[model samples]
Target chain A: MAAVLPPQAAPHEFLRARTRWHPLEIVFWLSTLLPFVVVPEYLQLASQIAIAALFAISLDLILGYAGIVSIGHAAYFGLGAYTAGILSKHGIGEPVVLLVLGAIVAGVVGYASSFIIARFRHLALIMITLGICLMFYEAANLAGWLTGGADGLQGIKIGPLAGTFKFDLYGKTAYSYSLIVLFLCFLLARRLTHSPFGLSLRGIRENAVRMPAIGAPSDAHIRKVYTIAAAIAGIAGAVLAQTTSTVSLEVLGFQRSADVLVMLIMGGAGKLYGGILGSIVYMVARDQFSGINPQYWYFWIGLMMVLVVMYLPNGLLGGLEKLTARWRRSPT
Target chain B: MKAFSLCLGGLLAAMFAASGALAQQAVKLGLILPYSGQFADTATQMDNAIKLYVKQHGDSAGGRKIEIIRKDSGGIAPDVAKRLAQELVVRDRVDVLTGLILTPNALAVGDVSAEAKKFTVIMNAATSIITTKSPYMARTSVTTPMLNESLGMWAAKTGVKRVFTMVSDFGPAHDAEEGFIRAFKEAGGQVVGSVRFPVANPDFAAFVQRAKDSNPDGIYAWVPGGVQPAAIGKALSERGIDTKKFRVMGQGELTSDEALQSLGENALGIITVFHYDHNLGNKLNRAFVQAYNADYKRNPDLFSIGGWDGMHLIYEVLKKTGGKTDGEAMIGAAKGMKWESPRGPMMIDPQTRDVVQDVYIRRVERVGGKLVNVDFDKVRNVKDPVKARMK
Candidate 1:
């Protein structure tokens, strides 16, 4: 009804309308490139934000789109990071290959874990996810020879992208590499979320009890989206490990899982742009606040998250959308 | 949307860019430390020492005023440490990097230091292989093996022949065990037994009882400076292990203030070895203690001495290079640079660029109703055993 589609409109035409790019979305992504010309010094921070945004989007898939809460998303993230780190340490230093392998490893692990995840919802789902992350953290700590234990995995040598672009101190290569990967993954996520499969996922999220009667099994849908989200998160973690050239136990930390969730909530769930915008705000706030008071910067980040959730309940992006809807309630 | 995107992008780019638009005349030093977390106290002590050094030395070396940029790492977040290092080198254009506490954080910064060819002085990270990670790095902090190896040999020399070893399982703890066993065996001592416990949130009751049951001449254990010391001390006492007869030896933490508070009268005869001690009877140390007390109003620890010497080395190297901040020139001058520190005479080992200092053997005894580790003997000019054996 909202789309004003004719009763006889073809399914393909409806799909096309749903997949059409918003002007703001296009402009927003394009603006990420401006840092290359304007602020070369901040390319490092830019790349980190891009990776975090990608991570947040991955969480949005399972948590926002599928209505599956995950508190231990870092399991996939850490797996992907450690995969890249371990491979690079063992002489498999190609960046592109490492990224692919990281995704594959995380995807496989996510698929294996989805059996347990698909059986639970809400409180149970959160507990299982958290427990899995704790297991990974302990395993990494116990296997000091492989993961470097408390000292962290050192001497991770990520080879140049395309055999030409080196990871420089200025972070020009790292930013470009991260941005490209993020865009490719973002496009895939966008396509997947626009299909009939995505509609089924929303149906399952809206009413799991009625979804099975309509031939959309909630478990299957959750499994598929959770795996997809894990793979995307894996890509993000790979980007981070490759760019930084070091991986620590903190990659598997609960703090990371919580922070990303906070990001998604602040930006608005189910809105792709919301996830991206939230990450930018959170990361930039951290960079700025830490400069003023490095000792208590976390306090500022916490306050900002609280303010966003309080004033804009559904999130900043939701609030913005509502305000825009009111401003142009009818076409001129 | 384009307008908003442009505005957001412009604002961020402007902010980060504005930070870099500072005057470049001063020699900038970027201090990356865990300033607000579990290790905050250690950061505070080390930071205070760096400040005190600048205050005493008038903050200028070789006609260049020192500009400090402090960054809080929070905790053992290696990625943050690495990113901060990169930012310091590229954005802040810092001449030297210092004040890293955790060994892992230092390891994370090693790549940046190597790539940028930035001279880095590690003030407190104690892993022996840290200096090996980057040629541009030099450590003023004592390595794990430096203290543990000295303790092992000293214990053997002073007639404790059989020993049981226990350490919290981690990188430095492994180093501690390896150093002690190798030195003890080399000095003609027998290791009766050994055990490793979890590094985080470990209960020492079972481990302590097991070590006590081994019935060795002494027990050599290494746990980091935290609640672990007090916990282990309580465990040892609860197991009825007399500290007077059967010696409990370690790398400083065994007789720390926390251990004394927990162990009580049982802490009377426990022996430990370390590079720096507040109880050292030298005039320079006394002055350092006095000045530190006047300024910070707290007793300076081993971490403080490391930062003090780090700042001193930075100052001396800058003076020698006449304000050149290049990695090669600074390191060249820093190597084998000997000075009389508050702790004692120390030098930077020319080949390895690691600290070579006196390791003191101290016994906990009550003096004027206060529990203190009084210095009984010393090992002069001890080098990190790992690097010494390697090269």
Candidate 2:
């Protein structure tokens, strides 16, 4: 039997030391690397997964970490994508410049919109976001000359990343670029989660009244987080537009927003790594099921969603974490 | 010196007369289509076909230059179409507008185009009601009821007595399915069951299962675009459903050689009604098929051909009217205009302003691992058919 030790048994006996690297973490890292070892086509798929994961992760930051639910997150994503497409079409093709511009545009929109959105509860916020997205969709269709209207903005020529790395169909460069961006964003989010501000956010989520009572401006913090999340989402959109070299009105559609929410919920919203894992699982399942039977694949997906909601409320990643915890606690 | 001055004056008079005889100003044409979202693929094909036609025929009508500016409606969604139409007419300041692929889009744009007194030529949309409802709106494609009625008559003649039907839950598909049901009944065929599926649904298993449970004498389906055929064909094959027991029909890019290859033998024996087929034995069609195949390395589908024909028809009208951009002159010239197209000779109805052309009933067959037209029969020249049913 292990001896019961005090919390400060040693100089390094803190929670950080106790959180040793688990086998699952090693497996997760290995699995993510697995796509790179496969063929070029698989690598392209992994790149898409990475971009999609980043988009979902941005949503997870606000929805899970900050306890804010957004139904119109695609607004920022689509806005960022279209901003890049519109700019490149009009002769601004530098990748770094476009990324910065996209983020700035999306962040400004988010900051402006958050003034109204941060005041609302879950349902009202969702509806308002949806309304804004629909408005943008209509506006895009109306401005045919600028946005390519309904046919979408096509034939977008993004010159090169930093005037060096060119995007190719094989997706080698795109994958690495997207992976790096995702990694950085993930690190920033993780750092935020562990910071004093992040703890205050958790405090706000736990009890809004108590956080303000302790002199924390919870609303301002939530709005700030929301704007940052939007900027991250915008970057993901820029990455997608750069890779695909085409932007359609569907990017701003309600379905896209819903899909991101579904991805976050399926992955384990509160966990940072869950977003990437969930996107991979969802996309792979979709590709496999659709190839097998195009008509009935949705039924299977729906069934799975129902099962997850009923049994594993915390999502796949959370469920796995729980299983691991239980295993560690039980006698071998 | 005085004689030379007279000669110069006479030459100037003649030059003025010639200039008066030939209209030489650029005519602005606005194109409104669902260019993005789910309808983006179809819109792209339509735009490509139109551009190709303009490139080959030159953008001059009569002697005047014609400029085509495109606007995207995003989809057949009504509100979006209305807003887009307003922007096209008010902002773009185009003389003539064309290209609406879905019924709702056509109707929405039609209203705005009429309100703005713009001459709108619908290239791909086929809602007959639009012409009867809005005088300013004229169509280049076949109407829903007319196409479905012909299909019903053909099915009756082919000894198909009972059928199961399904359509996507969109306005155009629903309208076409309803017309098919009504006409099939009138043509001595019984509709065993009918089902509607959501638009943009990727999976077809539940719908297919429902269809199998019905088990009618034949199946009549009206699904559009590339995805439907691929999904439907795969579902049917997995369910062990026989093609002979079904007669699928729809307006789709699925009839293309590439799409058929994807569907494989499952696409065989499927009967479809179309206005154009590359296999038709006509000089114009043969030339078009040759040129199109040479360029794209694939057979041009009906939508592409129809889009090409629409532009060609407009070009002919412009040439005939001496490059007039005025609504009255263009409309007058378009009436009863006859021209050789990829689908052979097509005549615009003087009364309804709809193109009356030959329609064909063809059965799909896999030859040398490629889907090609096997048995085709000329059904009818639904020329100037009463705009009554469209209302």
Candidate 3:
């Protein structure tokens, strides 16, 4: 079918900007370098943080940019994890191929589910997405013959990255692999957010009715973003599966989705760096606090979250950005 | 006053100097438990028991100061438990890894311990497959079938020809129920019917009613943890099915203090078979019970017994190795080792790394106006039946 241009106002300068790389992005990436120098033993934890960051960023693509609220994002994550795990166990042991396959499966699943997801808003939207995730969780549980049920899909052995650089006990390979993937995905997300499609999605997010009036296919854009986001989340799950060498039903759990949401909100949703920073802060804090006192650690985390929500509603990153902006504007 | 203060400072300095000369390497033991969720109560009990063991030994084992580090599993998520295990191994550099409540957490940590080659002693996890999963893993805990092996055979031998089974639908529950039914059937009994309910389900009236309608001579029930076991016992009593026509029997934890306290008089005369009983009439058990009660102000349950024995086993291993923390050396030293546990004589099977111990059959009866397990018979030298069946 032939496409028609809409009678709309001139695009904003922010929309016209092709690159979303801020100068601070280098500092963000550099900060990750310190873990290798200071605490090389914590590369496993760093890898986990990287994977979670990727998952949160995937959510940021749809939830932050397209204004869709999903409570079941782990559906894609678990899907990717199980797919990679099952395939690797069945002799498809190549890590790169397993990751790509995971993304493909999760993307297809997300695209199919997004049709119904895009038609609703608010509570209905949340419930439907949650229902889909719950269904997957139950399916994984009941298909004990294949998924291993509560015991988890065990004995998943992945071949080395590109047949070199094997995953080690210290998790050097896993950390590097996940960081590379996250950066690549972040770059794609950055470019997408500044592209015409990303702007239309943002416009739809701000006013879906106005978007349709301006002749933009809001539903199509939302579905496309959701599918892409699912693929990225799947890649995150692939990282987790390859790194951990096991996948369980907890990967698809409500807690996984909720934890990522908390990470994104804490980092600052809608911004690219928000997910990365939020994951680092939340995961590292958990590792440290939980180590200090396992019994009462959650209480401390809960208190910090409460204080953050109260004083910094835009999250730590967003709050810091506002503060810095204000300071710079006032010539201080 | 200045002279007295100077004397006290001299005393402190001498003590520090003396301690510095005698200081040996600290043995860092990391205990991972579900300290915040469904298994939290069990975790606390086990933690206290381990602490008691350390306190009794003056906080050192084989001349090395025993330092304990704890990590919470949150009871449900296995991946989080795995990461924590990794942290304990890589960051904390723990000499030994122990303590997890659920089977999944054990398996998750088992993978980490296997890869990292960390000495792991499972305290309370009852899954049969954990030992086989990791070379570094050895369990002081009993498997799921240990409790039911004697009870089922005895029920059939006692002329209970037809049986109904009800248990929570899960991995360990299935193991327990299968153990009972297999033994009962082997002893010439028929399982007339079976029903399963969720572990978290509080109301068991419907399931109880269904079992009653099946008209079996006895019901072989197993519900571990939570209030579900109490609810099931209450439903049975309220339905008047305990009035001679039907027999109710289960694993010992069904009539645990938490369950018995809630089930009250309704739990009276319920038969069960477990590895550990508070009223074991042994010197070690009597001392353990007295000390545990004095310290925690509560009765020691199965999980506490597991933890107490786990510490004793670790202490013995430390003695054998002269405080070396090599995983392979510890595992080798643990195999075929016997100990006079609070429960009775227990030995770690050389091949399976699972404990071979006697199972006790008990009936819940009022002792000092409180429900208590009274020992009746013992199933001696019970090994890992899962591995045994394969052989």
Candidate 4:
């Protein structure tokens, strides 16, 4: 199709068209900022939601778009956390510098691991990722001198955001900082997903056997996406550690990996907004349910998951798409 | 319809204003605990004690009306605990923070308390360095070194010379193991062998076999007060390392009533040390146990005392400050405060703001047709050795 295109044709014009911002997306982003005005007391929770959304997006990149189903995605997230936490503990308190360092370290690890990860699929891939996650968890557990083990990485003194906005008792600075990072990362993810590289990942997901024949190099695409996904997850972890100023073993626990996967699946996969939307629902529901009945909050969460899966297998975004399908542009 | 709706909205606004005014003067204490998940029973025991204390002593402490607010952390989630503390401070305007059940969660809230200057009381978290994290913090719970080190010193002092130590691989267990080892070595006792089993459920047969193979006169083991203790007890008996032949000793929880139930007669000779036990028959403790059992229909564990004594400390501080709930007043009044608790005489050490109390060495014995920790020996005025060295 590209070879037969006329001189006046723009390259990947359909991709650009799909990437164009929906009016609702603009409204959604603006509404995120509304918590600052309307519910400033929940700034800490809002910030946590932002971090979770970023993490879910990272998972969606590989699992949703690249056809990789990883339950141990928390490996990269925890890696990023420990990286930032260790740096802060040692007096490298600058948040941005630690964040970038966290990304680089996790991205490198992800790139190396992807060599093995790219070869496997389905059950083997799930077990391999879970095994890797357990290794990191155990490593953190054993290296109590460095990682602080189950006691958590303590004495982490994260500096003020941009050397100006101190994280106050009200969490004004932390929420804003997380929101900014989340926004920038969201933009990068959106741009990445709409590119020819992202299209190759989709093709690989849909038809791995045919994608290699079409010169897409399925392994390379999968590996690249996995690396980026890990890097993004690292950023999310860094954000969490920086904002909270602590990292416990739970960051790398099996529960964390499982929860993120659940959030992504509940939000829907493949489409870009599914992960973010799912995080919002899941996090908010958790906060509310736990508030109402902390002892049995998981029961409510489980019920919601069952309901979402049963009624809307495609997730909240999938349901929304169906409702608004008639008004939107049809896929070419 | 519009007039009726307007009337209903006005009534609602008036009710909100009225309730807000009523809640304003009440002294709010935010209780954060793992009220769900694996630690649910721990939370329940402590919470039940808190309720018992409130029932015995009227809710009002100092000059103000008391209000209790509960937040369930669910587990060792430091991030969630910190957020709950923040919410307690900013949203609920709580005057004090309490009921922190995990060390990491306590440390996390310590940051919040230091920043917010809210007087925080450690209820059950026992890590020694935790109180050092916040100036406004004081601990009612006993530290690992306080109990374990004393137990080790006594063991060496009495008769146990050669020992093998086996404990769970975690911070508290490591702390306990180190204190026991150091104290025993200082007293000229030789440690035959030591190993940290996996933090979670370890294969008891293998671990018990390894300990037995060491061929030591004494086997010191430390695990949390849970199902693991019973399993370890069963494993030890199965391996023929009975308390009768080889001296078995550890933290008090090893021979808890539930562990006793499972171990039956095997739990009889096991020796352990701790600050509080439901079976301690002191006058105050008898009263407390009677009341607790009457109300909750169960024996209050070590956690129950921490919660009970913590509430008592709050009441005393409130009375001292004449109901001043500010950080400075509450913490200042709390320091060096001596009180008679069900645990016996306990003082909030003025220097470290950690608990100083009597640690009793008890033998689990059959009394009145049930297993009970019979207090046979004691170490008095014991400070958390780790923090005692600091100042």
Best by TM-score: 1
lDDT of 2 at B11: 64
Off by over 4 Å in 1: A1-14, A330-332, B1-24, B200-203
Score every model by TM-score: 0.94, 0.54, 0.92, 0.93
Q: What DockQ, on C-alphas, does every prediction get?
A: 0.57, 0.02, 0.40, 0.57
lDDT of 2 by residue, A165-241 (tens): 77643456677788888888877887776567776877877776678889998889889988998998889888877
Clashes of each: 0, 11, 0, 0
Worst 10 residues of 2 chain A by lDDT: A11-20
Q: What shift in Å separates residue A246 of candidate 2 from its native position after superposition? A: 27
- Give the alpha carbon lDDT tens digit for every residue of B126-201 in model 1: 9889999889899998998899888888889889889999988777788889999999999999999999887774
Better of 1 and 2 by DockQ: 1
Model 2: residue B296 alpha-carbon error in angstroms: 4.0
Task: lDDT for model 2, please.
Answer: 0.73
Please write out the lDDT profile of model 3 over residues B1-391, one tens digit for every residue.
3674586479648854754675586888989998876668889989989989988976777678789999888876777788778878767778899997777778878888888687899998887888887998888879877667667888988889999999887666778898889988999999999988876788888888888888888988888766776788788887778723467888877877778788877888888888897788999999999999999998788889999989988999888877777788889888888999999999999988899999888888887877788998888999877778866
Candidate 1 vs 4: which has more DockQ: 1
Please say which candidate is ahead in DockQ: 2 or 3: 3
* Candidate 4 positional error at B212, Å: 4.9
- Candidate 3 Cα misplacement greater than 4 A, ranges: A1-20, B1-23, B200-206, B243-245
| Residues A62-162, model 4: lDDT tens digits | 99998898989999999999999999989899999999999998999999999999898888999999999999999998999999887888889899878
Candidate 1 backbone collisions, by pair:
none
DockQ of 4: 0.57
Give candidate 3's iRMS in Å, 1 decimal: 1.7
By DockQ, the candidates rank as 1, 4, 3, 2
